[model samples]
Target: MTPIRPLPSYLVQRFHGWRATTYQENRAWYRRLAESGQHPRAMVISCCDSRVHVTSIFGADEGEFFIHRNIANLVPPYNPDGGYHGTSAAVEYAVTSLGVAHIVVLGHSSCGGVKGCHDMCRGLAPELDEKTSFVGRWMDILRPGFQKVAHLPDGEILRALEMQAVLTSLENLLTFPFVRTAVEADRLTLHGLWSDTGEGLLETYDPARGLFHPV
Candidate 1:
């Protein structure tokens, strides 16, 4: 195997500085966390977009949340076909092992994944339409969502699809037997959120109203 290159000097220096300060300020807290293991109350599934700061938005501390990130924060329907399912594996671990009380699906404005789905559905992005495209296959999970908003005008499609992504994930979560069992037993709850990155606004999905409202 090829030897991996060393990390950049600036990042290494920054890491050292952060380690020193953080350990100095919270050594006992860090030690306690290591000893106790994680018992987070919530699990957050969100986009891999660097602009979406899950920790910063929630002001979460170490071990406060179990977070999983993917291209568009999508969750596939439950399929126990013995296939390789990274997202499903994470959900299983979170629901069965972690025993988390809540699962939050967070979608954001101007998501490239959502835009790609829109473009592909509209025949604008042929590359994403290819069968070998991993992103295309992954985004296929949101095809149903795109269909629901396909009748809307071009200007309104992206935002609708973004919210749809959150709703889709929430719906898929229920397909998992463990998740459904926990929810039915009143042990777990589900939440959906959409963020307007440009405006720094957060909106939550209201299942009763079937809409997203600003928080």
Candidate 2:
């Protein structure tokens, strides 16, 4: 079922007017994209949270970034038949087909997935039956993340867990053969990014320093 009675006039008018100007600026670009197909510079794996808009946050134009959004911006291990291969397939396409130079795992503060991990850690989450199966399985990807930050202060745990998840996904990305091959050949780079929604801050993970610092 869908509801359709609350359309805001201003927004509706703006959207309608936008396409004309947008098409003018991007007509050729769209034609080229349609003809040559996507050759994005980077692939951004980000949370589906409405507040975190990767393209808008980075000011990237159409076809500039290939993005995949999931409940918690996670990258599961390469499982060819784990029922749904949406996210993994997106990564494969970005690396192998699109030849994206960089793959960035972007995590953010106040993530629902992080919150779910916290709940699962406390043994307060729902049972792992068939009906509630995916929640348990999906959140398992962040088990090490929660474990890594378990000893930290309660207030800091969520953010730390989120950051650790980004690192975990970065490692998980290498589980795919194409990604590993690209990285080894110097055709790919992996990055972890954490955005503080409340404070409007962005940090990039530094593998050498083992910490995320201002970008």
Candidate 3:
């Protein structure tokens, strides 16, 4: 293979700027974190949306959260077929190795992934229906979620589907044996959240009410 190229100038400049500011100001904290390794309390499984900033949302510092991002923040039902499961691997690492006490499924409004699922379910996205489409196969995890909102109006289906993704992930998470065992032993808790990107609003799922409430 050819030698790897250097990072883009803009990204390199940004790194330097951050190092000169944030890193310099918190040099001791950074060193301590590096030495001690991460002992994070929570694992946040969020979407691959750039607008959803997990750190800024919770005012979290470095090493505070073990984050795993994927399309629509989905967690597939447990299956040990020796297949490559990136999201499942992250969850296992976060729960089993990191010993995170909480697992948060963070879904956001106007998410392209969720919209894609809505479109695919309704036959509007034939490209995503192809067997060779990685995104299509990955998004099949949300097919059960889309079923709940399939009958809704066009104006409501997308948002409903977004919320469903969070709930679906929360449900699928328990399908993992370790996750279920930890939760049963009172060592782990699962949470579902939906954020309105434009309004900077967050709503959490209330299991008792089976609904989302403003947080």
RMSD to native for every prediction? 1.1, 2.7, 1.3
The deviation in Å at residue 64 for candidate 3 is 0.6
Give per-residue lDDT, candidate 2, residue 188: 97
Candidate 3 lDDT tens digits, 63-116: 999999999999999999999999999999999999999999999998999888
| Candidate 3 segments exceeding 4 Å error | 1-4
Which residue pairs collide in model 2, if any? none
Worst ten-residue run, lDDT, model 2? 123-132
Which candidate ranks first by lDDT, i.e. highest? 1
lDDT for model 1 comes to 0.95
Please, what is the TM-score per model? Answer: 0.97, 0.89, 0.97
lDDT for each residue of candidate 1 in 1-215, tens digit (9 for 90 to 100):
77898899999999999889987799999999999999999999999999999999989999989999999999999999999999999999998999999999999999999999988988999999999999999999999999999999878999999999999999999999999999999999999999988899999999999999998
TM-score, cand. 3: 0.97
Clashing residue pairs, backbone N/CA/C < 3 A, model 1: none
Query: lDDT of each structure?
Result: 0.95, 0.88, 0.95
Span of ten consecutive residues with least summed lDDT in model 3? 113-122
- Model 1 per-residue lDDT at 14: 93
- Candidate 1 vs candidate 2: which has greater TM-score? 1
TM-score-based ranking, best first? 1, 3, 2
